[model samples]
Target: MAATDTIFALASGAGRAAVAVMRLSGPASGPILAGIAGGLPPPRRASLRRLRDAEGATLDRALVLWFPGPGSYTGEDGAELHLHGGPAVVAAVASALAALGARPAEPGEFTRRAFLNGQLDLTAAEGIADLIAAETEAQRRQALRQADGALARLHDEWAGRLARLLAHQEAAIEFAEDGLPTDLDARARAGAAALRSEITAHLADGRKGERLREGLLVAILGAPNAGKSSLLNALAGREAAIVSARAGTTRDVVEVRLVLGGVPVTLADTAGLREAADEIEQEGIRRARRRAEEADLVLAVFAADVAPDAVTLDWVARGAVPVASKVDLAPAPAAIGGTAPLPVSALTGAGLDALRARLAEEAARLAGSGDAALLTRPRHRAALSETVAWLEEAESAPLPELASEALRAALRALGRLTGRVGVEDLLDIVFRDFCIGK
Candidate 1:
């Protein structure tokens, strides 16, 4: 599409609301705004107008806002129309714009224009996409940081440092007898070490940033009548699954999304694992075993009335955290050999605070609160990992030229993280994940 041809999309959520927004962006923004509003407002200002078609027939009374070229969202020009939130009104305005040379925007075309216009870096553009698609608090926070160019700024600093290091290396190698300093080797290695430490620090957050961007999966598993579903409800603070005095009320996996300690957890309360007579119960038990294998953390709940035993010991091989549920009913249990068992009661509030605190502490550890690392996405992790591999190369050889080359290679990989120089294919994946309106 030509950059001069204006693009428009319904910026507001579809369906009924108090009002709807239709956005137009391009060089023709002024004309389009004038055509719809019968006049263009002063730049960066909003004005109420009676919108009409080309024939002067009334369409909808809208509040029109205009943003002049070189200073607007798309960097050329942009306009917004706040029309009444009726489907017919929105459609009519859109049809009118189409008749006047505006084309419907493709998915993420608006934000793509922002990127092309240099208003946002590739990372910030993706952050915009993520922010719009955010479903949990943690995801929203991470996306907001990304959209704010936090990752881009960090990557740019590293890139600049490497560029300077590369320049010094070229001078030392090409003109050693010239004025190049003798500490070139030392300086280059030191720079590489600094960059490597930066990368290593960011990469140290083992899969927490990934889990935060994409919600974490946690499973609840244990013996029968352990109040597993009750614990799920207690943590979820709602009756997500049925609870009963009977042994196996939940015969299938019950999954729910809860912000446990500020991180989104897709908590799955699975069936009670035991030898079953019925076909469905046996199938559920099998599924429970399968889920335990894939869980990020399994909270093995047992009644406080029962003490730990060898049968329980048989199932603790997968790093499951033993949870003594219904702590109000009996004494709290202890962990086999590690941290103490977390005591909690689904009915009373006893030990619930401790559970939340423990979960928060675990989440913080996962997030690398102990380390001053800034990682926001899984893609970032992959790029940092590759960069760290090259840093390892530099550390081993310690040659100025090799270190410079390795640092450059590492910078290129991180550039992909922020879409600074090369990332056309990655942008396709990022924008494909965005909503059409975004």
Candidate 2:
């Protein structure tokens, strides 16, 4: 919290490895670097040096770099030490850093300082966190765009327009006493309406970006003997779920994570949907229905050898992918619920590659393929929604004064989205989720 104090942390993963990166930032960065490495390296240049302890004992040979204030990541003097990653080496360096008046950084403190010093906005800070947590290629692309200020640029453009409207409205108020023949108020109202419409349209994007950020969920549903578990195992390339000839073998949802079309997906193999005599089986059936309702996509599986069940046929009619399993046993049905079912033999690996390709295409359609800037978090949605409401109120205000007030409120809401204004309360919520090293 005190920007004047020096902070240090392991900028790399903590463990015994080839190298461990210890980062320092604050006013004392230069002196701390001097104390440990005997001198500062050229700005932004890496130099090998002998690291020493408080007793002037050689701790380890390391690489050190120094960055002067105002041009560094934290907008303050900063330094980095790449030392051999052993517990003893790290401990010795940490002890020397403490002796030289630097303390351990809190979670996100370095980035928080960067934000405070105008290196990046709040939204960009969040994007950095997302980039660190990203698990798939699509996710990495999305996070990288966000961290580069895509969302901030969009929100800033809106905020700039709102500011212009506020200024116009104020000008109208100031000149009204002179009886000046002007239509500034009318123009302001029209601008508010147009901006509100644009924001609303942006909000209508089916939450594809958020799903991509959080990953997609696909549920497998079918009759008791439809080989749903077997299909799940076949796609996951492992025995993720137990397959049995007996009905009701899967009594709960079995989840497996895999990348499809460069998007992370959680594939849930659910209990078979059918009437059951046992209470436990009935509970499993209830859970299956719930999972289908919550899933972004559903796989309606049917055994090729068995007559198509009406329950799964209904799901196929309702837009689920119709998959005919057990193709090795019998030929796939030409038509299932008025459409061709994708035939796959989960037992023999026949037609599985085609099924996987189809699923990947569907995932790309439902979740984005990382082509555009998307609203990736719930906070973005909420803030934009609130801004739209305020803009609407401004457009409909009876007086220019009220309209100006509403426009200011709208600007404030938009600011919160990009961390350009009114961000004191949001820092904790945003940075607390970050890993300490970040």
Candidate 3:
């Protein structure tokens, strides 16, 4: 949408409530609000006003606040109308706004305007979206950190260093006849190498930020009737998966969400893993193996009353947490697959707390506490990866000119990450997922 167009949107959650906030931004925001509210309220101070249509028909009385240009959220004129939240009141006020030259805002248009106006960078805009969608305490804190520009500050610092290095490299080429330090090129390459090493170390974080942002996946795998579904239900505190005595009862994966150690987790109860005569059962087993392979963590369950099957034992050997289920029926084996199995009786609610604590510890280990500044999206990782590649090229270039070009390209990549440059195409992709009026 054009920035010249006056945009307005319902800023609060939709539906009946005590109050609804309607936001407006653009050059005409002040005038349109003035006309509707019988003149603009003192800038930044809330004033109750009678909102009316162009024909002077009363719409709704609203608490209005005006924000003058260049100092507002979008770095332009802005206004907010706090109105009675009945649907009729909201509709009437919306009609009045449209009649006065304001158009409905697209999803995330407000935040997009903020980015375009230099009020906040692309990373911070993304952080705002993440904060809105955050489901757990960890997610909220991480999003808040990102929205507050922690990632942007770190990236900008790196970009500034790289820019200085590029300038030095270019000086070496441009002033070679004047003898502008023979070691300039060498120092630039050394700096590039140092920056590349730091970025590479950042990349080796085991995807903790990404895991915490998107939540971790834990898959439960076991033989038929091995109490896999029972364990899942117990952990979820609800019957999320079907449990039955019949073999191959759960023929598909069932998933439930949980918060472990403040990190969001998706726990999947997969089909039983075993050879089967039926086609459906074989397919189920195949899916169980695939889920385990894809999961961030795997819970390999064995029945305490039955001998550990070779398939489950193999999974246990492959680093899956061994769990001896149905402990109410029989004592757990001293060890399974060279590791002690966690004994649990889902029916009796015995050892469930310990199991939860163990899972929480694992979850925290896999996804670190959200206090540190971390890359929260795949695009962030991709941009940094591209930057690292260019930095490496700069360090190894055969000529100073080539190294300078590589460093420039690296700066462009970093620019894309923060929307400082070359980001017209990326704006849509970045903001499309945000809610309207963000």
Candidate 4:
């Protein structure tokens, strides 16, 4: 992982394809390419070349492109070899690269170099990782916005203001003996209060960004033989769970992924809630209650022909969406616990569309469109929360010196957020999850 060592890696997908791209970055990139590819191709332009080994034995014909330092990705001399899509071709090229003193890149090494070289901040680097792993259109848009520096811009603006306040407070303290303006301390405190308010407002976004990034969890809960599994199969358009006439057919949680309103969601069908004597069924019931607690939304199902259980009624009273299952067999009650139940018959496919539409609406409301520069990670929230605390300290500090120290601490927290300063320990944690070769 040393920057002085030239690194090479397969940047494209593995296995057979139209082309396999081998990426290189370091000071020796140009020389390494020239050593193996007959000679360096025109910088930033595709040029056909016959790649060879150290012994000058031809290996493969490839398209080569050279990127000079200070302007390329990683801010270093880099090159790309578009080799023929074959395992042997890629292996030979990799061997040749190693023979020429270029070692294989570690996971996220290329992007780490880019960050160290000032090409991007930590937030942008994380955004790139999220973009690579995005599963839906909303996630993609959000990742792209963060990668394009939207989040960085917002944080940097706040940091700049905080820095100015710190500077003003320091000046007031340092120049108080020289008869400087006495109101400087008061002005800096006022500015701290204003900045704290803005940051607090941003923090109160209902965690929409984090929810959107991680996806939402919805749990289906009901008593035995309440048709909960049947409803799950109907919503998923597949028999994701075992449906049977037995009371405890589902003894564990079954989950399925679905996209609602372009936002990814995990729908979990848990075991029917009940007081069971069987140890296994009792365990399942316990797990079901735990899942319901963790769910962003819950579907409290009641059999249309049977009386609603007290447990299910309690969930509905706690804001769960009430669903009347088996509507084809029996008419749904007008209301359950003062809340109108959504009538649905999984067997006959009746009223399913309306229920799906309602779920989609809830999903959209919980995870908004990815248009705003929202906080997408827990680390971001924690850092901002610490910053707010420091700002409050600065606002209420008894001495100007203490206020200046608090302001500096707040700025350092912001610095860690964007990798502007003091992030040596965090580099590994931040980039460990990234794919190799970036």
The C-alpha local distance difference test score for the whole of candidate 4 amounts to 0.90
Clashing pairs in 2: none
> Can you list the residue pairs that collide in candidate 4?
none
RMSD of each: 7.5, 6.9, 6.8, 6.8
lDDT of 3 by residue, 108-133 (tens): 99999998898999999999999999
Candidate 1 residue 405 Cα shift, in angstroms, is: 3.7
Q: Give lDDT per model, in order.
A: 0.77, 0.88, 0.89, 0.90
TM-score for every candidate vs. truth? 0.85, 0.93, 0.94, 0.94
Candidate 1: tens digits of C-alpha lDDT, residues 324-425 = 888788888556545477888888878888877777666665643212225766677888788778766765665567865776676678777776554333
**Model 2: ten consecutive residues of lowest lDDT:** 429-438
Q: Report the backbone clash tally of model 4.
A: 0
Tell me model 3's lDDT, rounded to 2 decimals. 0.89
Tens-digit per-residue lDDT, 266-367, candidate 2: 999999988899998899899999999999999999999998888898989889999999999999999988889999998799999999899899889888
Q: lDDT per residue, candidate 4, 279-381, as tens digits?
A: 9999998999999999999999989999899999999999999999999999999999999999999999999999999998998888888889999999999
How do the candidates rank by lDDT, highest first?
4, 3, 2, 1
Alpha-carbon runs more than 4 Å astray in model 2 = 421-438
Clashes of each: 1, 0, 0, 0
- Candidate order by TM-score, decreasing, is 4, 3, 2, 1
